[model samples]
Target: MAYQTFRQEYLQVPPVTRAYTTACVLTTAAVQLELITPFQLYFNPELIFKHFQVWRLITNYLFFGPVGFNFLFNMIFLYRYCRMLEEGSFRGRTADFVFMFLFGGLLMTLFGLFVNLVFLGQAFTIMLVYVWSRRNPYVRMNFFGLLIFQAPFLPWVLMGFSLLLGNSIIVDLLGIAVGHIYFFLEDVFPNQPGGGKLLRTPSVLKAIFDTPEDDPNYNLLPEERPGGFAWGEGVSWNC
Candidate 1:
């Protein structure tokens, strides 16, 4: 009965977010078990191009180091915000959420090349938080039960906390930058007088991932309005 209950809860997670969190956990587990070395997964341009270790490009974004404080912290934020965005803002729009992942990853990878950084998982998490915060601007949020702020300032708050941890602010800044770019293109610019949607999801992906609106079982909930940006209405997430 206990196992069945656990299975039921596990099955309740949305698909994209579930797969992502599972990958992060399994990747870290592989490291903790000594099945793989962190060195092998980190981004190295020479190894990627010359040695043809193409897997590093994607692996680098998967592992957040062995199980510890940083790993646990990042995983929690990643899973929470990613799931929220997927089930809330990106609900029924699976293709667009996947596109956001691809877009953020590509931008982070390109920046990683120049910044000499490895393991962009945290930055990716920051990007997700940023995008979600922007879309739900009127929402209120509490940080660590101390600082209270609106949704948009969440990214900067994380960055400030990172600074206090003696960690480099580069990663957080990169994430905020990338997230702003996505928000600008997808939400902001598209609404401008002359602008149009720049980040169009391909029809192939839409056909495969998107849920059909005409389906009889599709229950359009009020919380899922405007891609789940029902700000100042839903319960706030304390980050």
Candidate 2:
């Protein structure tokens, strides 16, 4: 009975989020079981371009190390914000969400070529959080009950938290940069005087991922008001 309930709830997650999160989990599990090594998964340009190990491009963003605190933390944030974004602003736009994933992943891969960082899964998670926070700027968040701030600052706060954990901030910064570029292109710039849409979801993706639905009454989830709780300590808040 418990397993059945779990399966039902898991199946309820939006498609993109469910697939991405499940991939991350399974990839990490494969590593933990010694079915694969980090060398096969990390972003290595030489192995990818010369040896034709192109799978590295996507696998590099699938593993988040072995099962531990870092893995659980990243997985939680990844699942939470990814679901919120898919069900909130991108509710009816699965194709566009997929395009955003591709765009951000491609940009990060390009940046990875210059940097020595491996396993971009965490950065990708940060990008999701950053985008969601930007779109829901009015939502209030509490960080471990120690800090209270608006949504826009969530990404920076996570970066700061990473610093406190003795981890490199470069990954977080990269995610923020990519997230900002996406937000500016998709949300901010188009609203300015004489500005037009710069980032468009390719028709191929739309045809492949989107279904024809003409719901005149379709409405996005309403933004949650301020005074919501934090995401730390295993507590999550809706935004």
Candidate 3:
């Protein structure tokens, strides 16, 4: 049964596949162009006591890389998870994928600051993404190409990592909070029957501590939207 869902969700062309492809290309470019330099990563080349650059907050994902086995492993994960989330099988609410990529990157940067290290910071940020994807209800992914299986504990596994690392706990938690608020605002304001002045909602402004929950992402996007199925007419993911 799970295998069937996996095949359906990940096999063929997931809705966000194109986005995933773009992510991979950018990552490769960053690495090849030497743009993924450590000196340029944190906006603090010397690693001395200095303030954040603000730009690195979002530019660092383009710098993701690891030596030897870790590099290939995470690169595969980047491809795998991004593929599912981009596929649009979840049939999510308005432009969820776009927001996930954009804001998620920012959240990662904020996490990096407390981590006091660019690598660790990005790691936690990626973990937050997977956790957010897991929290999305009634959604799952199956990987047949390399990772073939089902998982109900994506969020727990991620949180568990966060728990084990005491050095990174404080900032990591903050990143989680940031991601949660983003999800809530996206789902809530517009979800309110008949759209009003969503730009001025209390939740968007305050970002107050709430239930500590965010939208769990999945291999698919909102089915209600037009792009949910078969590449939205002439568009083809295989390309």
**Model 2 — TM-score against the truth?**
0.91
Instruction: Estimate the overall C-alpha local distance difference test score of candidate 2.
Output: 0.86
Q: Candidate 1 on 70-115: residue-level lDDT in tens?
A: 9999999998999998888787889999999989999998888899
Q: Against the unseen true structure, what C-alpha lDDT does each candidate score?
A: 0.87, 0.86, 0.47
The candidate scoring highest on lDDT is 1
Steric overlap count per candidate? 0, 0, 21
Off by over 4 Å in 2: 213-216, 219-239
lDDT of candidate 3 at residue 15, scale 0 to 100: 41
TM-score of each: 0.93, 0.91, 0.49
Candidate order (TM-score): 1, 2, 3
lDDT, candidate 2, 1-239, per-residue tens: 99999999999999999999999999989998999998989999999999999999999999998899999999989999999888777877899999999999999999888888988899999999999887766667888878878888999999999999999999999999999998888888888999989999999999999886677656433434311122233344432
- RMSD in Å for model 3: 11.8
Name the weakest run of 10 consecutive residues (lDDT summed) in model 2.
225-234
Poorest 10 consecutive residues by lDDT, candidate 3: 230-239
lDDT of candidate 1 at residue 45, scale 0 to 100? 88
